[model samples]
Target: VNILTTLILVWYSPDAKADAPQWTFLLCALGLFAYQSLDAIDGKQARRTNSSTPLGELFDHGCDSISTVFVAISACIAVQLGYNPSWMFFQCFCATTLFYCAHWQTYVSGTLRFGKVDVTEAQFTIIFIHVISGIFGPSIWSTKITSLDVLPLRFATVAMTIVCGSVSLFSIFSVVFTGGVGKNGSTVAGTSVLSPVIPLSFVIIPACIICLKSVQNVYENHPVLYIMAFGLATAKVANRLVVAHMTKNEMEYFDSVLVGPVMLFLNQYFNFYIDEYYVLCLCTLWVIFDLMRYSAIVCMEICDYLSIDLFHIPLVDHPITQLNKNGTTINSSVVNTGSRQTRSRRHHH
Candidate 1:
């Protein structure tokens, strides 16, 4: 999805590849509108059912994470940032990095707050920006902000960058102060007591690579980059799921709003090419496979969580028996006696 969405921008960039027709904006706007509308309903439905499971949370965050990239691509298109690499890097960095910061915040603070406007809330606002740009033209965002006289997009992007930057800074520093009494009498490990860096490297390393490659554009084929990025993204999401499950914490998904403007700056200053399709295919397929594997693991874990039967029904009954060549007999009672004894010696979820 990361590669696909990025390609969409490359092909449609009027200033960069210029492969897309003039009507690209209409198509993109409509797709974004439909997606955002449907996205809004998912949370409502989850609430209506009063069932918020790990799967639902994963689905929500997974979609939001992927869509965050798409939103950046679209915003860059709207602002005519296709030919600017510096801005492109900044935009991608802003979106991806800020989001990672949000998760990190929850991990350290043990709480997630929106302050009235969160990523999802800002998503609709961004969609509105795309719609206006699509209709009145991308130039609208470039128009100066009244009184301030700065370009609207410029002012908005700078303001967002500052605010989100501060939040990220706070979260990063909070890691050092985490240990204390937690909900349900659980101990919250503070950075002073312990550092989750090793485990968290599973989250940070790939993120750094993604933001770096997005800025560099050195790979003729982006397979290595995309595969690493997607795999890490999924793992990071799963990490949150596991932590939330074990800690019984709740979190919300959000995207950094400044990616669009940062992308504009990158394009305006140092435009680079990212249309390496074959490499993208490799990366996308790898991530898709990773998700499949992740799903299987999750299913198994869920079954274990519920203590659902995994072995055949015959194993549940004592009468089912198998006779060996001579006189030996294998039955559920004998099999379970040993297995159950072994299992009893271990721990369970």
Candidate 2:
């Protein structure tokens, strides 16, 4: 829903201009709030349905990885940061990088830690920014504060993100460098502590180099597309990190999702045989498909191996013997009906 609403806003204001209609921002706020509410409840729902498994954790974090990208983009658009593609780029990548670092540390520490001011708070802050933008106007972000430097309110978000990101990075690095649960202070998969950086660089390095070197200014012209492509690429790697943590498997540095960025980089290297914008469009499409395909395949594989269903609660009914009023015994069998069954087995799908 958040992605859909963001697309609507993009349609209304392709560049997220300050003069875009107020309704677009309101829609974005509602969508993000809905996303946050749903994300919070999903775990509870899983536990309630007795379907909680390792797969549930994987799926939850996987969705979060993808949502981080959309939320960051929407937030940047809400603040009219598209006017400054550099800041917009930093904001979006900052979000993805922080998210990746969180899991990267988890990959080492074998635990997911949340700080006092964590994801929930950050999400609410973005929602508030959307509300204010919707109520006042996107132009309000450009209003200069009474400071010696006369900074815009939008720049305040950049400052806050930098501080928060710095603290988070510090905490994550402390965990990663200190040691892992494995022998000799390695990662959970017993790989090098610094191995995760290689995949991350595959996303960030190409993004910076390609965007900076593009003769056609593809990124500056279409910041949303460029960011979304790289964002999904980043999410793919982050998801792999989660998988590695959960399964205790070594994560390879090379990822198929890197193909998208590589294409853009090669296009720049070739001096734009084809239009860079078209390549970006193709890159976006490919990354979206690749993420979905990989996620679906992984979920299906896990479900099959665990004898579980991804979306449904599996119920097994057992027979019960009851005593009759007349002192006779009555035997009743609980059939394998649908979800309304009153009896369940020890193992759930």
Candidate 3:
């Protein structure tokens, strides 16, 4: 639903404000609200259906890592931020960075912490922005505040974003640097606490270089496609990080998803023998395919190993049996009993 809503914005309001139908903004507002509600309840539904597993958690986060891009783009379009592509770029990437850092912090601390003002609050704020745009048209964000006289609403929004992002980053960094849960203050994966930074930089540095070096104004002309492609690449990296954290494995510095950004970067380096726009379209397609393929294969492997279904709960409840470190068969019924007891205690509270 969220992807379909973003596609609508891309079709009718590619430039966000120019020639956009008024109703599209309202639809965006509705679609995003629905997405948020569904996302919130996904875990509950899994548990209710007796389908919760580590794969469910990974799949949920994996979808969220990608949805971050769609939601950010939809909000940008709602506020008509495409007029200033640089600001649009900052806002979109800032969102992805915050999300990535949250998981990075998790990789170090062995816990996912939420600040007082977090994702749910941010989603509501964006929903409100969409509602305002839907009612007043996207021009309202360009109007100066009656009291301030100099501050455009959109710049004010950007300022708020920067401030909130800064505080969030500060909090994440504090946890990441101080909360290692492995030997000699390393990460949960038993690697140096800072090793994850290399993988993150690999994702961000190439993105910055490619967007800045687009001689054909590819990013300027196709900000949505450019950002979507970049978002998918980042999402793939985020997914790998999540998998590494779950499996207690080391993350690779290079990823297949980087191919998309590298394609555009190398084309520009050689003076764009193929038009940058065509390359961008192809890059976007490749990133989408690569992310989807990687996600499918990983999920299937996890399901096969765990002896679980991806989307359905078996009608007959039975314990999953697995070999332990001692090579003894262990029944998962004990784990399920503990989970149910935890749920029961929470319900009482």
Candidate 4:
């Protein structure tokens, strides 16, 4: 359903009509409405039907990841920022990263937390913003509403950067706070320290590289190519998170996931032509990876459901169970208890 909506947005995206014609905006409005309404109830429906398998979870998240980029893409058109490359990159980069952070929060803390300004709320707000833009036309985003910035593109770009940065910062700090301070006020050491930094590094390393490259080339002027590059990189990171969730493993996937295609997107400001084939190639590779991973997950889930234990893939297990359920998975007491039990069992034998 969300895919259909995305296709519809792509269909109407090139409407060269003056002010985008209210009718085109209406189509986008209707599509977003249908998607959000149905998407909201999909999980509950799955749970009701007792079909909430791991495959369903994977399907659900994958759809969300795709729709997130599409929705932001549509939003860009709605607000008349479609012609700009910086806004495009900002939308895709922020949306995909924040979605991953939500999952990261779950993996480490075992808590399914939705932030105060999380995705659900953001989508709902965008829906209304689309409606307003549809009614008022794109001029509303540009009219002087404040002294800070009058243009929606300018305002949105800055506001979005701050919000995305804030959310990323909070998620990073959440990791450190998870184990950084002990009851006795001592600092967490070794693996505990690395765990917090691992997730942070995933976003930080990519952001650092992308921003530096953006600065050197002034990528803001070439939003089309900038978004394509950033989107591909973000997709790779999101894929790693999905694989991590499926396998129940904690793997380091930072910039190490950057393959050949993403590298070509990195250099230069003087050259201005975007290779459509280049973008399509990267996108196709992404699709193939998504399909294979998704198929493996579906097969794994079906076999698990049927109680047929066969080949084991480490990607689907919960990584934090190594810690106790009460959140002491890393406590010294638990470690010592297991050590003592091992010696006692040997003695009894």
Candidate 5:
């Protein structure tokens, strides 16, 4: 399946080999569609045949991740070696990082969920944007202003790049701080205690700047790209708010309603080209990290159900723990139970 997926991706990849004819792009697209179709089939096969072992699950995920990376890289290379701007490759890299950060944030929070019945707003938007851009290309909406002709497509590309860069930076910081706490408690590098203020301050300041910039761009140019960029930035900020609130309060359906539109908007506007191979590779690494983390959680849950004790698990030695210990009988079972309860409570919402 992995080999098949790779071959399909390569064939569908827009990046043309110097030795190959121009018709290869068409062949590549067809192969990509076939590969995607097979992606669905493999999952069904695993379920129907009762072959859903941990290794099988891992392999499936690995293949999916690799295929995505291959597509991204191919797009980048196609642009680099073909008709697209060279700088577009950098944009692709940033976009891939943005995707990874979003994925990481969800996985680390233990709220990672996947489905086929429902299309995620991000996925839907991206697919829509790809189709529209492919059909319309550079002539989507052309307007002229005082000695200058502006293309909406170019604006869209630029806006997407800016949004991708901003979001990627935000995601990197948020994931580092939050995931650090999850893995090592309040302190990072065994020192420098992390406070709510640290992350909140870091995230909010830059977010405010970006939002203001986006708003300014919208007012000055009123380009469709700026609007889309603003939406992406707003959605990311809103997501952070939702996550923080979820940590403290109940999850609400209304929150989804509020945030869903921005995600949908971003997905529809974000574009990928053959010039972002490096960026796509980086995203693949990010996805691997996320999948590994998710797999770790799954393994731990399985161990708990099977009554198997994994050796030497790292425990977060928070200040609260020190305060709770008062030279009383150190009941190991009580400690374990307390830890498990706390973890469960943290993840429940």
Candidate 6:
């Protein structure tokens, strides 16, 4: 599945066939949707049959990360070939990395959720928008009103920009805080001893500066891009906060202190910290954290499936379990017996 997805992306990439027919773009868009759907199916099948393994989970996420990278690369090639702005490609790439990192960290920590508003849900929504707008060229349809055509392209572009931009900002913030405390040198902090002020400043001061610059850049020339960037950053932060709060962990205390003070500081000193170094450092840290998260997720999945114990594995002690009507333990022995009974019942029925 991963190979096929990559092949399709490469074949339909902007660089693959210069001046390709308009229909090819639609084909590429459709291919991406199909790839994502197939990716989802493998996992769905595993869970439905209760055959899910750590290996499968690891492969699924790994494939997803790789597939996203291909999408970004294809976008970059397409943009460079004059299909879209280069910045759009960069934004998509950054957003994809941040989205993966945030979700990967949350998943490892056992704090990730699936619902109406979460990373997974948001991703599907974004992809849907991309597919629709990419195919139809972002024109809205209205029959009741006059011959009104909504330019979906503008909205879709802005939405993509915002989702990616916000995620990148959140990643930068988390990296600074985590790096300041020297916990894994990534956003996945297992511990921290720094004062709330220092850590918050490390994270927020830079984020504020980037966001301000991003806003100014938009206001001066491209307001639409700016809006999209801001929206993306907001969504990423909001998603993180929701997951963090929902986990109900002791770490929430530290995060609460960190988030509040930093936000306050950003509001107070929005203009004092703009510089290239800050943006470079934040982006660099984000990349590092994203790579680590991707690798860690893959490793954890492999270890789980093979039942191999690794000293560095996070959340390994909390293996997923099932419960019965009486809420008692359901061990492997019980699982086997239950399977046998289920099979017999199916035959009888």
Provide the TM-score for each candidate, comma-separated: 0.56, 0.91, 0.88, 0.64, 0.37, 0.41
Model 6 agreement with the true structure over 1-349: per-residue lDDT tens digits: 3335334544543232233334444555566667767776876665554556555554555445445544544433222222333344344446454544445445234344343344445446545544553565322211123333543233344455577567555654454343532345422344332222232233434444444545334222322232223323332333333333233222332322233224323543565354433433343344435444545664675577577543322221222345667766544322232123221111110
* C-alpha lDDT of candidate 2 relative to the true structure: 0.87
- Higher-ranked by lDDT: 2 or 3: 2
For model 3, the run of ten residues with the poorest summed lDDT: 340-349
lDDT-based ranking, best first?
2, 3, 4, 1, 6, 5
- Model 5 weakest lDDT span, ten residues long: 218-227
TM-score of 5: 0.37
Winner by lDDT:
2
Candidate 2 lDDT tens digits, 109-203? 99999988788989999989889989998889988877735777889999999998888899899999999988899988999888999999989
- Report the lDDT of model 5 for residue 58: 37
List the global CA lDDT of all models.
0.49, 0.87, 0.84, 0.53, 0.37, 0.41
For candidate 2, the per-residue lDDT at 23 reads 83
Q: In model 4, which range of ten residues has the least summed lDDT? A: 340-349
- Model 3 misplacement above 4 A: 147-150, 317-349
Mark the regions of model 6 whose C-alpha exceeds 4 Å error after superposition: 1-17, 74-86, 107-109, 114-159, 163-349
lDDT of 3 by residue, 266-288 (tens): 89888888999888889999999
If both were scored by lDDT, which would come out higher, candidate 1 or candidate 5?
Answer: 1
Off by over 4 Å in 4: 11-19, 82-84, 146-172, 180-229, 252-257, 263-349
Q: Model 5, range 1-349, lDDT digits (tens) per residue?
A: 3234324434543342222323333344445565667766876765644344444443444444334444443333232222333333344334433443443444344343343322133333343433443444323322233344543234444455566456555645565465533435332222222233333333333323433434223212321122222223322333333333234322222322222223322332453222223332333344334444544664576457555444333333232221224444322222223124232111111
CA error at residue 134 for candidate 1, angstroms? 0.8
For residues 1-349, what per-residue lDDT tens digits would candidate 4 score against the true structure? 5446544545655421125555556666777778878788878765544445566566667667666766766666666565445555566666666766666555554444665666666777677767877788765766544655535443564476567568765965576356533333222222233343364455446544544554334344334334444454455556556655556565464444354234434422334245434543454466446545655665676677766433322222122223444544441211222112111111110
Question: Distance from true position, residue 251, model 5, in Å?
Answer: 31
Instruction: Please identify model 2 stretches exceeding 4 Å from their true place.
Output: 316-349
Worst 10 residues of 2 by lDDT: 340-349
